[model samples]
Target: MKATRQLHDLGQSLWLDNITRTLLDDGTLARYIEEDSITGLTSNPSIFDAAISGGDAYDAGIHAKSLMGMQGEALFTELALEDLRRAADLFQPVFESTGHVDGWVSMEVSPLLAADTAGSIAAARHIHHKGRRDNLFVKIPGTPEGVPAIEEAIFLGIPINVTLLFSCAQYEAVSEAYMRGIERRLQAGLDPRVGSVASLFISRWDVASNKQLPDELHNKLGIAVGQQTYRAYRQMLASARWQKLADAGAMPQRLLWASTGTKDPDASDTLYISAFAAPETINTMPEKTLHAFADHGELHGVMDVDGGDADAVLARISAAGVDIDQLALTLQREGAEAFVKSWHHLLDGIAEKARQLAGKSDGAVLK
Candidate 1:
């Protein structure tokens, strides 16, 4: 069996962490689902920025929207929804078969609202409704401010993909918010089955601490963090608190591994993919990493529920003078900033494309 199929059989869902008009239009996304076992996809400001600025795939759409007087972030959201709605349709089978747990396409709320609790909540609700697809998740950062927004959106029955979480504590914070939202729903006589995922960003831990580590400690921090977070996730799912909600029909907010692509060229390309494999969890990998894993990835074993060696690895990093707690905060902040940067660049690309297309139309009309 191919490694992708093996991973699926072993109980992990492989989702492509990319979406481009070209990928969807050229049937590549569908081929991945049919051939490589990729059941879902995810997109962010960075991915969309690359897709819009890197190719002409979006030119016609941008032109049409431009003629309709749509520009900036509004224009970008429409273009993204166009792709996500199509991608969601492609994954509809997996979604149905899994009872809505497996196939999901995530679209992030505006990164500009990462620190604005009310703003984030409002944006998430708007985006989720705009997509108009039950399988679509509005991604909100697991920032301090975003936690409240997450709770609100969940209570409003918005499926969420909690992004930018870097530690077990962060994951737990968002998980609690999800539970609270579900509990609120139950109290209000609403359905408690609001689907959500707490996205733990891997790979960045290694990138942030790689230079400070001894050679033995290199490339190990991220997996260690993942192990710790997964331990928390499993425990949370089994707790009495979660059991009560489950009895009330609430779904557990799944633990999703994001940023799984290896960063160091010297390391194994599938390092994160293999190390973080576990059942009932989702691994969203960049297309490059996805293809690399589909070709040669191995599932030696799933991650230890007890967080094997996670404490030891983390201790060593702490002894190496890296404050894990402080680092987590820094990474989350940096990630939010990076997203905002990507958001601005995405809008810039859209504006420029709209201008170029408008210029062409004017020229043609003159002729």
Candidate 2:
């Protein structure tokens, strides 16, 4: 069997951390789901920006929407929804098959609202409604402000993908917020089946600390962070609060490994894929990583529930003068800024497409 399926049977979900019109239109996304055992996909401003800016895949839609008098972010959201809805449909069976635990496609709120709690909440609701697919998740950052919005979105029954997390502490806070949302649902006599995933970014830790730490600790920080977070996740799931919620139909917010692609070319291609393996967790990898894993990945063993040597490894790095807590805050700030940058790129790409298509109608870039 393919290593992708091996991971699945080993209890870790392999999710595709990419989506594009071409992937959906060419049946490539479907093939990943069917053949590689990929259960879901995720998209963000950067991914969409690259897809729309790279080629003419979105040309006809740009023209169609512009012809209907829509433009800018408004126009782009429609175009994005078009792709996500189709992707959601492709995963509908998996969604149904797994009772909604798997088979999710995530669409993020405008990065412009990354710090506005109320604004993020409003945008999430609008996008959730606009998506019109049960399998679609509205991604909210795990920022301080995004926490309340996450709870509100979940309280309102919105499935969420918590992005931009960098540490075990951050993951703990987001998990608490998830439980709060479920508690509110139970209080309001509503269903407690709201699904969520606390996305802890990997690879970034390695990239961030690589230059700061001694060579002995190279590429190990990310794995250690993941181990620590996974331990917290397991503890939270087994807590009495979570058990009570689970008895009332609530699902544990699965830990998702994001930013799984290796940044340094010197590292193993499947570094994140194979190293972070744990049951009841999700690994969302870029398409390249997914293909690499399918081709040559190995599932050595799953992560230890006790976090194994995570604390000792972290202590060693700390002694090397790298403060994990301080660095986590810095990384979160930088990651939010990166999202804002990507959002602008996505909108700029949309605007450029609008102008080019208009110029084409007037004759340019195409005859």
Candidate 3:
């Protein structure tokens, strides 16, 4: 069996952390769903920026939208929704079969509003409503500012994929926000089964710590962090508070593994996917990583619920002078900033494309 099929059978959802108009129009996305066990998908500014700038797939759409008075973000959102709505429709079967527990595609709000809680909340709702798909999740970063937005969005029954989480503590904060939202809904006599996922980034940790670690710890930090966070997640699921909410028909916010693409050239390409294969969790990987895993991946077993040696590994990392908490905060901030840069690049690329399609050539090309 393909490794992706194995992982799916073991209860881990394998999601493609990418989306492009070409992938959809070319039937590649559909092929992946049929053959590769890809149950869900995710998209962000960086992915969209690459998709828009890398090819002419979106040119006709951009030209049409621009002609209709949409440019910049307005145009990008229209393009994105069209692609995501199609992906959502493709995954509708998995979604129904899983009882709404899997097969979700995520669309993030503008990263420019990362710190504006109110604005993030409004954007999330708007995007969710505009997409008009039941399985679409509007991604909101789990940054300090985004927590309230996440809670409010969930209370309003907007399915959310909480992105940009790093450590167990960050995941815990977002999980609490999800629960609070569900609790409020229950109190107000509303259904508490709002679907959500708390995405904890994996590979970036190793990328950030690679140069600082000794040979033994070179590519281990990310997995250790994942193990630690998964432990916390399992505990949370078993806790009395979650049990109470579950009894009230509130679905647990799943823990999604993001940034699973291998960044270190020396490491196994499928490192994150195989190591973090815990049931009831989602692993969203880039297309290259997904294909690599599907071709030759191996899953020895799911992650240890007790976290195995994660505590020991993290202790060694701390002894080596890396403050895990501080690093978590730094990574979150940097990730947000990186997305903001990508957002601008995407908008600039769209405008440049619109100009080119209209036979005007005055704006700077977005390279």
Candidate 4:
């Protein structure tokens, strides 16, 4: 069997961390679902920015929207929704078969809203409603401000993918926010089966710390952090609070391993993918990483529920002067800023494309 299927059979979800019109139009996304067991997908400003600027795939859409007097964020949102809705439909079968736990497609709110709680909440609602698809998750960062917005979006029954998390504490914070949202729903006599996922980034930790560590610990920090976070995730599901919600029909907000693609050329391409192989969790991979895994990946044994030697590993790293806690905060802040940068680039790319298309027609330019 292909390693992708083997991994899927082991109960870890394999989701493509990309979306582009060509993937959909050429049936590549559907092929991944049917052949590679990719049950879900995710997109952010960076992904969209690349898609919009990298090719002619989005030029026609940009031109049409531009002609209709749409530009900037508004135009981009519509274009994103178009792709997500189609991808959502392609995954509908997996969605139905798994009873809504497996198949999902995520669309992030404007990254500029990462620190604006009210704006995050409003954008999530608007995007979720605009997509008009049940399996679409509106992504919100797990920033201090975004925590409250996550709770609100969940309570409002909008599926959420909490992004930009870099630590176990951050994961727990968003998990609590999700449960509070469910508890509120139960209080108001609403359905408690809202879907959510706490996405903890993995590879970024290693990227940030590798240079400071000894060679022995080079690519190990990210895996250790993942192990620690997985332990917390298991404990959270076993907690009395979660059990009560489970009994009340609330779904456990799943723990997702994001940024699983290896960043270092010296490391194995599937390093993060093979390391984080546990049930009821997700590993979203870049397109190159996904294809690499399918080609030659091996399933290591499942992750340790007790976190293995994660604490010990973390201790050693801390002793090496890494200041793990402070670094987590820095990574989260930097991640949010990076997304905002991508968001601006996406809008600018759209406007530039619109101008190019307009000049081709009538010597006009988009504002």
Residue 249 alpha-carbon offset, candidate 1, angstroms = 1.1
lDDT of 1 by residue, 1-367 (tens): 9989888888888899999988988899989999999998888999999988998999999999988988888888999999999999999999999989989999999999999999998888889879989999999999999999999999999999999999999999999999999999999999998889989999999999999999999998999999999999999989999999999888889899999999999999999999988999999999999989988888878899999999999999999989999999999999999999999989987898889889999999999
List candidate 2 stretches off by more than 4 Å. 363-367
CA RMSD per model (angstroms): 0.7, 1.6, 3.1, 1.9
TM-score ranking of the models? 1, 4, 2, 3
Q: Which ten residues in a row have the lowest lDDT in candidate 3?
A: 358-367
Better of 3 and 4 by TM-score: 4
Which regions in candidate 4 have their CA more than 4 angstroms from the true location? Answer: 363-367
Q: Model 1: which residue pairs collide? A: none
What's the C-alpha lDDT at position 265 in model 3? 89
Residue-level lDDT for 60 in candidate 1: 94
Candidate 1 segments exceeding 4 Å error? none
How displaced is residue 307 in candidate 3, in Å?
Answer: 0.8
The C-alpha lDDT values of all candidates are: 0.93, 0.91, 0.93, 0.93
Model number with the top TM-score = 1
User: Number of clashes in model 1?
Assistant: 0
